[model samples]
Target chain A: MKVLEDRIRQEGLILSETVLKVDSFLNHQVDTELALEIGREFGRLFAGQGITKVLTIEASGIQFAMAAGIALKVPFVYAKKKKAVTQAEQMYTAPVTSFTRGETYQVSISRHYLGPDDKVLIVDDFLATGAALVGLVTIVREAGAQLAGVGCVIEKGFQEGRGLLEEMGVRVHSLARISSMAPGEVQFVDHNDPIRIKEKV
Target chain B: MKVLEDRIRQEGLILSETVLKVDSFLNHQVDTELALEIGREFGRLFAGQGITKVLTIEASGIQFAMAAGIALKVPFVYAKKKKAVTQAEQMYTAPVTSFTRGETYQVSISRHYLGPDDKVLIVDDFLATGAALVGLVTIVREAGAQLAGVGCVIEKGFQEGRGLLEEMGVRVHSLARISSMAPGEVQFVDHNDPIRIKEKV
Candidate 1:
């Protein structure tokens, strides 16, 4: 986590006093080394929690999810943004509102992928308003699967997302938590590395 | 590549003689061990080449790209499918036709991520019609970057992808080449233990 915070300070750009433009290393232009380290951290946190599947919403989330999958020796599945006709008719569907895109869209995963037996660990790149995570949780509940916990590489702790997930009683584990962002400084939430936390945030 | 051919034989589902569903292991839900092997195989193929960057498209392509990136000890940049205002305006962009979704969309990567000094190896999950590859190549060219070659896990030899790349004067390396697929039967282009090109029926 110190490595991430350091990397963020060195490479990440602050856009509009709030948005962290990690396009060089995190989301757009990926750093496999950093991702692998982040994946190992996630594995350390949730590897022993009977995680049958690691779920994430697609585009930015796939690489980190795959890294975690590799480290934990478990498979990861991402929800497709669009539903191609070739996909199965039976799916667990949910609506997600993107704070960046400023629109609501339906994302779904095939029913064949998730089952009642799965204890799912949801992971993502960023959590702002918790809309995407909420959508993912809806899909997991629809599948009758157990929500093991939610994990994120970065979390904007000043946002309402943390409280929302906590309200659902889902344990949330974020590697980097940005507690405050004023003009010049960014603060992070205090944490003791969690083996497992039942409460979300 | 025998292991890959065997995996296709055992776990692949033939749909309508044209679509072979390996999503259980290759896409959707990824098998990390198999993916790792595939990545190493790619590393062996391009070992002598100076591959500075591994470039791929987002979602399904990210997993394989990351695997190759890790094996090759290089960073990878995945071209995002969606548009965001935060991205660099001077980025190279190209349009691609998708066989799965039956649509055409544009993909782009920031000009900063790739440049004249970079030697890139483009990677993807599947190469069917070579449309996606075309888009990636266009972007790479626009950035004045040197493309070492293209690497794919599975190539549908029956399809026109290889011919298209060959016509464009690009070398392609595929682990497993499928000659034909008819519901129950899937034929592979054979190879020796060293992955030499053997006879193909």
Candidate 2:
């Protein structure tokens, strides 16, 4: 997580107190090696969970989910933001509001993919408003699958996302947790702090 | 590639003459081990090309791009279908019409990630009408980057995608090329055929 925090410090563009863009490496453009390392970290975190699947939303979360799936040696399923023409089967659906895009969209996964037999690990790039993650959690529960907790590449620790998930009794782990950030300076929660570690589970 | 072809034969649903759904493995619910094998296959195909980066459009293409980037040991960038608030910089944009979605959208990549010095390999999940691939090719050209070629997981051989890319003097390699398909039946163009081999490069 230090390497990710360092990269964030070095390359992350902080547009405002609430807007931090790691497009140079994380989302828009990606560092494949770093992504794999993040996956390994997630793999290590949830190694004994017997994860049958990795779940995420489309676009941004696909890479991290794919990486985690690779690390866990399981298939990853991404909920589509919009239902495509081909996806005409029964689906588990939940509405999510994007903090960055400022729009609410329905996220869905085919009923054929998820069932009671599956155990899912949800992964994503950023956990900010927690809206999307909340939506995914709903879908996982709706599918009757066991939740293996959430793994995030980056978490906005100041936001209500972690609080919401914890309230839902979903254990969460973020590789890089940003406590605060401004245009020129950014602060991170000490990843090794006993308090934060106790709160994570 | 044989394994990919076999997966398609076994799991692929032939929805129509034009639509072959491999979402059970390729896109929606991705088989991580198979995806890694795909990456390795792409790596073997474009091994000596000095590919500095792998590129693709967002959503479906992200997984394949990530895999290819992993195989090539390079970074990958995905063109955003919609420009986000954080992406306020100059971008290389191109319009693309989706064959499946029956819509047109502009795909954009930031100016910072691509340049003349970079060699890029564009990867995507499907090569159908070549609309999206053409858009990506235009963006890569606009960035003044050297394009190594395009690698597709599956190609609708009956479609114009390959012809369109070939017309642009671009090399393309698809792991599985489907000649035709209909409900309950699918046929693939023999990969080892000398005529197809000569045309690929």
Candidate 3:
């Protein structure tokens, strides 16, 4: 996590108080070695959960989900943002509103993939408004699968994302937790503090 | 490649003469180990090419790109299907028509990630009409990057994809080259033929 935080400090572009872009290495362009390390961190955090599957939304989250799946030696399923021509089977659906994109879209997964017999671990690239993560949680429940927890590569702790997931009794863990950020400076939640309540990998 | 061919034979659903679905293991729900193996195969094919980066389009191509990046020990970049909120910088863009979705979309990559000094090996999940792959090739050319070649997991050899790339004087290698396919049968172009002109990896 410290390594991620350091990389964020070194390469992250802070556009505004609310906008931080790590496109240089995280999402748009990726560092595969770093991604695998992040996955290993997730695997270490959820080592004994008996996770049957790793779930995520398409595009951005696919790499991280794939990484976690590789680390845990399980298959990863990414919920499609929109139904494609090849995907015509019956699906479990949930609607999500994107704060950044300023649109609402349906996230769906084939019903054939997840069911009551599965235990799921949800992963994603960023946790800000938590809309997509919440939608994924709904689909996981709808499929009658056991929710292990949520793992995020980066979390905007100042946002309401963690609060919303915590209200649903979903344990949330983030590699880089941003307590605050500005045009030039960024602050992370101190994990070394004895009073820090969040779980550490 | 044999393992991939076997997986397709066992789990692939042939919807028509032109459409074959391997969502069970390739795209939607990904088998990470198999994907890694596929990456290793690509690595074996493109070894000694000095590929500085692996590239692909977003969504489905992210996993294979990540896998190849791992195998090659370099970074990977996935072009975005649409400009996201976080991506506000200048970009190199190309238009692509999706044969499956029946629509055209622009795929863009941050200009910061790729440039004249880079050596790129493009990897993707499929090579059918070569629309997306072509778009990526254009972007790589626009960036003035050296392209080693294009690597595809599966190719519908009956289609014009290979011909189109070959016409561009670009090298292409597909792991499983399907000569033909029907509702329940799929034929691969035999690699054992001594007269085959294509490079075998």
Candidate 4:
């Protein structure tokens, strides 16, 4: 996490108080080694939880979800941002509003993939508004699957995302928790603090 | 590669003559172990090429690209499917028409990540119409980067994709090359053939 935080400090572009671009490494262009390390960290955190699957949204979260799947030796499923022509089967669906893109889209997963017999761990690249994460949680419940918890690569600690997930009784863990940021400066939540581990159901 | 071929034979759904769905382990729901193996296979094939980076388009290609990056110990970059909010800088853009979605979208990558000095290996989940791969190849060329070749997990050898790439004087390698498919059966291009080793540029 220190490495991630350091990378953020070194290369993260703070466009404004609310906008931080990690396109250089975390999201757009990726450091594969760091991604693997992040996955191993998630695996360690959720170890012994009997996770049957790792879930995430498409586009940005695929890499992290894949990494976690690699670390935990499980299959990872990505909910498509839109239904493709091939995805004609019945699906578990939810609506999510993206503040960055300024649009709401439906996210869906095939009913064939999840069931009451499975345990699911959700993972993603960033936790800001929690819009996409909340949508994924709804689909997981709709599938009658057991929710293990949520793991995130980076957390905007100042935002309402963590509060909303905790209200829903979802345990959340973020590797890098940004306390605050500005045009030229950024701060991270203290690692020694108990907030690193959110409340678990 | 035999393991991949076996998985396709066991779980692949032949939706049509052109559409073979391997979502159970390749794209939607990914088997991380198998993905790693595929990456290792790519690494073995492209060994001694001094590949400084691996490239792919977003949504599905991230896992394979990450896996190849791991096996080769290099970073990977995925072209964004759209112009993102954070991506406000200059970009290398290419327009691709998706036969599956029946729409054309522009894929873009920041100018900072790729350059003439870089040696790139492109990876993807499937090579069907070669629309997306051609777009990526164009971006790499536009960036003035040295392209080692394109590596795909599966290729519909019956399609025009391979011929198109070959016409462009670009080398390609696909782990599982399908010769044909129907509602219940599938055939692969014999791996023992020298044609499997595409003419290198």
Candidate 5:
């Protein structure tokens, strides 16, 4: 978590008062050394509860989920944005709105991959409005699977994304929690809720 | 490579003669354990290239690239299919046609990430018509970066992908080469050229 927080300070670019671009180190251009460490940290936090699989939406979340999957010795599933050519008919679907892309799309998982017997840990790069997490939670419920928890590299705490997931009784763990992203400065803002922050991890 | 071939044999499904799906364990549903091994194998193939970075088109490629990036201890960059709000103005671009999506789209990389001094290894989950790889190569060339090589988990030998990459003078290594996906079978194609298949870890 410290590695991620330090990297955010060093390579994460503040694009505006509301958005931070981690392209130099996180999403676009990935720092694998840091990803490995972050993956290990997730492994530490969710050592139990029988994580049968790691679920994530495509693109940015793919790498992080794979990292955690390796650390936790669990397989991962990527919810594709596009309909794959060989896709099956049976799948669980949910709608999601992206704060960054400014689009609402359907995210789905094949029924063949996820089932009622599975417990899933959801992972992603950033948690801003919490819509993506909500989408994943919806898909998990559709499959009759148990939600192990949610893990993120960075959480925009000022956005109150945590409250949305907490309302669903889902534990959210974020390596770096941003209190505010104003101009050139970023804040950690997680010590106020020690128990919740631990749940975030 | 044998492991990948075995995985395909075990879980890969063939839909029609042209479309094959390994969504059960490759891209859609990822086996991180196998992903790690494939990453190490790739590191062995491109070991002395002095690769400063690994590059790929986003969605499916991100996880594989991240694993290889970790194995090689380098940073990895993934081009975006959809533009993010935090994306920069200066960028390198190329057009890629997606078979599944049945459309042509541009893949973009931030100018801040690519440069003349960088050694890049382009990676992806599958190589079909080579459109994505070629588009990725264009972005790399536009930035004047050294393309160390290209790596893929699967290559459809019946398709024109490898020939196109070879014509471009870029070395390509595919873990499993599918000669034919005849009706219900996905057969692993053998390479007659030792130069293309033989390498050390």
Candidate 6:
């Protein structure tokens, strides 16, 4: 997490108080080694949970989910942003509003892939606003699958995302939690502080 | 590669002559171990190419690209389907028409991640009409980067993707090359046949 925070400080482009772009390494372009390390961290965090699957939304979250899946040695399922022509079967669906894109899109996963017999760990790149993560949680519950927890690569700690998931009784873990940020400056939630501990159960 | 071919034979649903769904293991619900193996196979194929980077389009291609990146010990960058708010810089752009989605979308990569000094290997889940791959190839070329080749997990051999890439003088390697498929039957381009060899460079 220190490494990630350091990388954020070094390479992250803070456009405003709310928009932080780690595109140089995290999402748009990726550091594969760093991604795998993030996965290992997630794996260490949730090692004993008997996770049957790793779940995430498409595009941005795929890499982290894939990495977590590799670490956990489980299959990872990404909910599609939209239903494709090939995905005509029964699906568990939810709508996610993207504040960045300023649009709401339906996220779906085939009923065939997720169901009651599985335990799921949800992963993603960023947790802000909680829009997409909330949608994924709904789908996981709808599929009758057991929720392991949410593992995020980065979390906007100042936002309502962590509050929303905790209210839903989801144990959340974020490798790097940003407490605040502005152009030319950024701050992370102190990991040593007991008051700011991430996992809720 | 034989294991991949077997997985397709066993779990692949032949939805039509053109659509073979391997969502059970490849794209939607990814088999992590198998994906790593596929990465190793790609590493073996493109080994010694001095691949500084691995590239792919977002959504489905991220997993394979990540795997290939791991195998090659290089960073990987995925082209965004559209220019996001954070992506305000100059980008290498190309438009691609998706036959399945029946729409055309512009794919772009930031000008920062790729350049003349980088050697790139493009990886993807499927090689069908070559629309996306062609767009990626164009972006790589436009970035003035050296493209080692393209590696596909599965290729619709009956389609024009390979021909298109070959026409561009790019090397193509697909783990499984399907000659034909319909309903319950599928056939692969025989690997033993020298005439069906994939690399053209």
What is every candidate's C-alpha DockQ against the true complex, given to 2 decimals? Answer: 0.63, 0.82, 0.79, 0.75, 0.76, 0.80
The lDDT for every candidate, in the order shown, is 0.83, 0.89, 0.90, 0.88, 0.83, 0.89
For residues A34-97, could you state the per-residue lDDT of candidate 2 as single tens digits?
Answer: 9999999999999998999999999899999999998999999999999887888888999999
User: What's the C-alpha lDDT at position B107 in model 6?
Assistant: 95
What is the DockQ of the complex in model 3? 0.79
> Which residue runs does candidate 2 get wrong by more than 4 Å?
A191-201, B191-201
Clashing pairs in 5: A172-A200, A173-A200, A173-A201, A174-A200
Off by over 4 Å in 6: A191-201, B191-201
Reference-based lDDT, residue A10, model 4: 73
TM-score of chain A of each: 0.91, 0.94, 0.94, 0.94, 0.92, 0.94
Q: Which ten residues in a row have the lowest lDDT in candidate 5 chain A?
A: A192-201
- B1-201: candidate 3 lDDT, tens digit per residue: 799888887788887788888888999999999999999999999999899999999889999999999999999999999987888889999999998899999999999999999999999999999999989999999999999999999999888888998888789999999988776677788844322121111
Better of 2 and 4 by DockQ: 2
Question: Which tens-of-lDDT digit does each residue in A1-201 have in candidate 3?
Answer: 989988887788777778788887899899999999999999999899899999999988999999999899999999999988788889999999987789999999999899999999999999998999999999999999999999999999999999999999999999999988776777889844322121111
**How are the candidates ranked when ordered by DockQ, highest leading?**
2, 6, 3, 5, 4, 1
**Fnat (0 to 1) per candidate:** 0.69, 0.95, 0.90, 0.84, 0.98, 0.91
Q: What would the DockQ be for model 4?
A: 0.75
- Residue A84 of model 2 has an lDDT of 85
lDDT string, candidate 5, A19-115, tens digits: 8777778888888987888888888999988999999998888888988998899999988764666675677888888898788888888888898
Best by DockQ: 2
Model 1 chain A: which ten-residue window has the lowest total lDDT?
Answer: A192-201
Give a tens-digit lDDT track for model 2, residues B1-201: 899988887778776678878888999999999999999999999999799999999899999999999999999999999888888889899999999899999999999999999999999999999999999999899889999999999999999999999999999999999887656667778744322111000
Question: Model 3: how far is A175 from its true place, Å?
Answer: 0.7
lDDT (Cα, tens digit) per residue for candidate 6, span A1-201: 888988887788777778888988999889999999999999999999899999999989998998999999999999999977778788899999996788899999999899999999999999999999999999999999999999999899999999999999999999999888766777788744322211111
Q: Give per-model TM-scores.
A: 0.92, 0.94, 0.94, 0.94, 0.93, 0.94
> Weakest 10 consecutive residues, lDDT, candidate 1 chain B?
B192-201
